[model samples]
Target: MADNEFQSFLTELRRGSLTLAVLGCLQESYYGYGLLQAMREKLIDIEANTLYPLLRRLESQGLLLSQWDTSESRPRKYYEISEKGRLVYKELLAEWRKMQSSIDSICGEGEEDERFN
Candidate 1:
């Protein structure tokens, strides 16, 4: 594939995993920037532009709980995974494992170039 096609493929691949990664990150309470930093530390690159809207959507969907923390000079919105989020995460994780196993079977673990064959 050309560079542009490869980049597109990578973006699409990461898009599917981003929600799960964000959900897992919120297992403990964290503010927006903090969560971004944590993901970066874990080598999961999540852009702030993408993450903020996702947080709002997840909260609206009842999968996340958030509150304004004003203890410090600046008030920050902190988020955590709701009980529903935890349950959903568990189900997603199981499904991900099954999907990964299927992929590995087809790809033979490493050389993904011949996977479609």
Candidate 2:
């Protein structure tokens, strides 16, 4: 693959996981910057530009709840996973695990003994 094509593939791959990652992280309430920092701490590396829009979309989809915290130095919008979000996260996590297992099977991972059969 050319460099640009490979980059495009990688972008598409990462885009699928962004929703899962954002939803998982919102299990605990966090403001935008705080959530960005938390994802970075987890080695996920999402940009502010990308994350803010996603947060809005999730909220609009009724998967998240948000409130403005004005008691702080600067008012910040805090987000948390709603009941619907938790259910969606659970379903997504199961689907992800199933896909991983299928990929492993295709690769014959942990099937060292079977390789000789």
Candidate 3:
């Protein structure tokens, strides 16, 4: 595959998981930059432009709750997963495990078959 094509495929693969990852991280409240740093620390690479839009969308979807903190010199908005987000995250996590198991089984079978051949 061309490098660009491969990158496109990789982006598509990461897109679906981004929501789940964000929701998981948002279980604890965090501001935009703080969330981005936390995700990077956990090896989940995301850009600020992408994360900011996603946070807004999740809040609009009622999956997240946000509060503005003006205690500091600069005001910052903190986000946390709402109750609905928690339920959705649980369901998504279960589905992700199921899909991962199925993929693993298929790959393992292919490896076993290759050894036999």
Candidate 4:
């Protein structure tokens, strides 16, 4: 693929995972940058600007809860998944497993593809 096309494809890939990553990461409380770091540690590869805005939006939607904490000298907002968010996460996880099983049945080779995407 051309550079621009590859970048666009990558953007598209990230688009689908943003919500899943948010739900998955917020199993523990995290500030925006901490969430970015946690997602990166899990190989989600997201940016802070993108994640912070998403956290705010999800909080507003009641899927997440946030609080401002000043224990570290500078105040930062920490986010955690709400009860509704956990329910959504469980549903999404079930759907994801079903999809993965369907896809796995269609592929006869390459274990890494099954492991990664």
> Roughly what TM-score does model 4 have, to 2 decimal places?
0.84
On residues 1-117, what C-alpha lDDT tens digit does candidate 3 reach at each position?
899999889889989799999999999999999999999999998989999999999999999999999999999999999999999999999999898889878787578668889
* Model 3 lDDT, residue 66, Cα: 99
Better of 1 and 2 by TM-score: 1
lDDT of 2 by residue, 57-117 (tens): 9999999999999999999999999999999999998998898789889987867668888
All candidates' TM-scores? Answer: 0.88, 0.87, 0.89, 0.84
RMSD of every candidate to native, in Å, equals 3.3, 4.6, 4.0, 2.9
CA error at residue 96 for candidate 4, angstroms: 1.3
Overall local distance difference test of candidate 1: 0.91
Provide the global lDDT of candidate 3 against the true structure. 0.95
Deviation in Å, model 3, residue 51 alpha carbon: 0.9
Error of 2 at 57 (Å): 0.5
Please report how far candidate 3 places residue 81 from its true position, in Å.
Answer: 0.3
Best by lDDT: 3
lDDT of model 1 at position 34: 96
